[model samples]
Target: MPAMSRSTEAIVRIDSAAKTVFAYLDDHRHLGAHMSASSWMMLGSKMDYEFDAGEARLVGSKFGFHGKILGIAMAAEQVVAIRTSPRLKVWETIGAPNLWVIGRYRMGFEIVPETRWSRLRVFIEYDLPKAAPARWLGLIFANAYARWCTGRMAKDAARYFETAGGQAVPSIG
Candidate 1:
């Protein structure tokens, strides 16, 4: 069935050992550090308190960040839905001056036991306001952002998994 919303999808295969990818995301604190140039730096709530280990499974869990796009103030919130091994999924709602966009993002990792090579898939669904200007702007730049974020994450994940003791898989295009 059609998504009934705008979307962006990307995938990257990683070579790593069992639980490596899951462990990487399980460390929310360290994950942000690995992200370079993330506009939404304050991804989750509780920077001031202790990390809730169960947060990984909290559906409807939300967090927001204030940022500027093209120098204009914008706000975004993401909700956690799935965060188990082999699959990490979340959804985001973002609002700007006259635009509101919804994004459903997911990443999948498949670990190869002996070779330690893993396959990864990343997908994003971007739903924009049903207005002309909003649709226009989104069509112009949303995919670019998705592509960049996906590529960057893939590269960073590669470096992270390898250096953190997982096997290094040749990056796939």
Candidate 2:
């Protein structure tokens, strides 16, 4: 099947420094903390495994979501690759062998420094395969869902920074 791509982005101003925001994003475990509760329900359970990738975090990590369907086990895997600069952090996702939902995914966070805050621009792109009906459904809803999720994540992050005194909190689940 041919592959189709969809992307979405959301921006939010965080009352923190770019370094602090990047630090929060660098940790793979902190990912679920930024997502909405409904999103977490659809994802079922989250499992994360991270390995040392030398200079950067999340460069060689694997995030898995597992759920049950009709008494059968279902799982999805996202292998991560990260590139980091002073102001930009990019996370690229390559579909694992067992998971065929999305072909490729990339999420980038650009932290623009402001006078007393930082503007975080979150960009996410994913490729959907056209071979299966499920993939078609993903294509239809992926963009909107991604946008909603990203917006929620950005807002949650901002709120966390605001209430937690910009401290890096541990990942949830």
Candidate 3:
């Protein structure tokens, strides 16, 4: 069915300015490491692979991640898109049929600069199958997963700004 609920407007302000946020997010290795590590554990994905190496300059770049869901083997393909520096970034899934069962996974990010810091805005939109059980499970997991992912991204953004280097962002339990 249609999405039961969507938390598309989560915001977090990081200590770094807008430029730093832009640089960090645009840096493929930085973004990939932070997200890959977090997603691997949370999704129980076996291997997170980056086909881009370090040259992820434009959108449409593709990457794959291997994992299992409920003991069923799975792999996910992600395609980069809509690169808006320090403001907006979007990615769509190109792999994983099981994920398609629920809906398409889309990620959007925006940053607003304040006096000394920047507010990071993230939006996640997924179209769900028009089925009761799937919709129910989507709702249940959506909220919990969004919260988990949001906190992790914010923490990682902060560290990325402060350190000016890539570091593992701790998951917030």
Candidate 4:
């Protein structure tokens, strides 16, 4: 089957400046913390990060995650596509990603500065897997996984800013 495009987004207000949040999320290791640890969402698997092209900060940079689940290897390579900094940055998967559900995807985040805080929007636009089992699983779980992915990014940012070493929350607006 041909891959189909789908998207999921999560919006949350962080009690911090747009630049601050942008800098934090610009680091893949920081924004992708959820995937690095063992969690129910990952089915007891943890993926390690591989960075290239100036540590994956500039456009055309490549980075990936590699791990295993039940002895089955999984990997996804992504390249930075659009990066404007302090406001918007987008990256898309390259080649056919070997994973459990959704396949190729473009994921990014936007930060809108407010008076005393920032509104953050994390998003993932994905395609159904083309391989067996995962393709079928994509039909049933792609959206759910996308939601979890984006939501985790947003929630992590909020938590970062709400805790020590971050700005105090005045209000989420």
lDDT (Cα atoms) of all candidates against the true structure: 0.47, 0.62, 0.61, 0.87
Q: RMSD, each candidate, Å?
A: 7.2, 4.3, 5.8, 4.7
Q: Of the pair 3 and 4, which is ahead by lDDT?
A: 4
Best to worst by lDDT, what's the order?
A: 4, 2, 3, 1
Q: Estimate the TM-score for candidate 4.
A: 0.92
lDDT by residue for model 2 (67-103), tens: 4433445455555455564477665644532223444
Off by over 4 Å in 1: 1-4, 28-57, 92-115, 131-134, 167-173
C-alpha lDDT of residue 135 in model 3: 65
Per model, how many backbone clashes are there?
Answer: 2, 0, 5, 0
Q: Point to the candidate with the largest TM-score.
A: 4
The TM-score obtained by model 1 is: 0.62
Cα lDDT of model 1 by residue, 4-49, tens digit: 3544444555566546665664444333342324345223221221
Q: Write the candidate numbers in order of decreasing TM-score.
A: 4, 2, 3, 1
**TM-score of each model, in listed order:** 0.62, 0.72, 0.69, 0.92
Worst ten in a row by lDDT for model 4: 164-173
Q: Which candidate should be chosen as best, given lDDT against the real structure?
A: 4
Model 3 spans with C-alpha error above 4 angstroms: 1-5, 32-35, 38-47, 53-55, 95-97, 100-102, 129-136, 162-173
